[model samples]
Target: MARDRSRRSARGNRLGLVIVGVVLLAAGLAALAVGRGLLGGDLAATPLLGDRTNAVLAQQWVPYVAVAVAFVAGFLALRWLMVQGMNDTVGRLYLARDEAGNVEMPESAARGALEQEVADYPGVRRARARLTESGDHPHLRLALTLEDDADVAGIWRRVRSEAITNLRGALELDQVPAVIRMSMTAPARNPRRSLA
Candidate 1:
């Protein structure tokens, strides 16, 4: 998915560069025509204001140079804008690995650890965990499947408290926000069994 987004962003950058290039090329041609009097203008007189002919000729180079510089700057700006948009669109799809060696655990290992820690509580049938980033802090979200006869409010309170406690202890980070979401509640089983 990241690769796909990167490719799309690259394509957008290329398109923007092409547009800037075309604009610069057109501006260059216009500048040449205006400078050389090919656009049906007076050739002998000063093209610009003031009496400094040498300065005016030198200043004539400014428009072409400005167009080239503007083209490059505009292309870079458009590329940056497109890349930022792409990052925002796909940023939440994957978790960033922590740079700190101590916290650089495998994603599966972190999820498994969180799930095991949360599963010991009553009314929890199953649990899945994911680690995300909120600025510099690691954010954990746990989705718990509850038992059939469990009290939802009680389970939620217990799970939420237990999850925060365990995550803080394990990660040793007070900035973490551990969230518990109820994903499913199983249905009660029938006592009668049919033999076929």
Candidate 2:
């Protein structure tokens, strides 16, 4: 019922994406057929594309319009490709509290809060987190960037302790799975003084 609405099932969005993909796929096939001269020759039937007759459709504006449409298609295709590769993460984390009331927080919001808290430590440049669901369970994954001169071992230990305590404690969960990944910033090149 109403409580079920709180969790982000991802079903609706996933179905919507599937529909878009199918439409794009149909459009692509049509474009391919047109390009391959399947519609007879250099001329093609383009309803709403221009005039119905072939000779009238050969104006200079036609090719330019085609090019513009192609550019837009390319952008949409790129965005679709990116979306295909990324993990869908719109799930909400349900938090237990001392009171009997039900509480839920958006996964992105929790990640943002945790990322900011982790960035407070020295040597850590920044942090980003994501929450995703596996079956009925939720997991927190972290990506962190460190300064060139940062202490790896010490910073890692601190990060683990703080992440576990703050995250699990706030969520009121006895256990929360985490995945931590770290990357180091490249060292800055020193500018040499000119020798007079």
As a whole number from 0 to 100, the lDDT of residue 43 in candidate 1 is 52
The number of the candidate with the highest lDDT is 2
Enumerate residue pairs that collide in model 2: none
> Per-candidate TM vs. native?
0.42, 0.52
lDDT of 1 at 107: 51
Q: What digit string (tens of lDDT, one per residue) describes model 1 on residues 1-196? A: 4346667978987898899899999999988887888876675244456667557657877889889999999998888887566422112222234565333445566567768866877777888887665334566767889887767898777656766676666655665656567865646466677889
Q: Which candidate is the best by TM-score?
A: 2
In the order shown, the candidates' Cα RMSDs to the true structure are 13.1, 11.0
Q: Candidate 2 on 1-196: residue-level lDDT in tens?
A: 2114323435665787899899999999988888777976755554426555667567879889989999999998898778657674656777654577757787877788889888988999989887766323567778889998889888789877877678777777777677789999988688587899
Candidate 2 yields a Cα-based lDDT of 0.76
lDDT of 1 at 35: 86
Report lDDT (CA) for all predictions: 0.67, 0.76
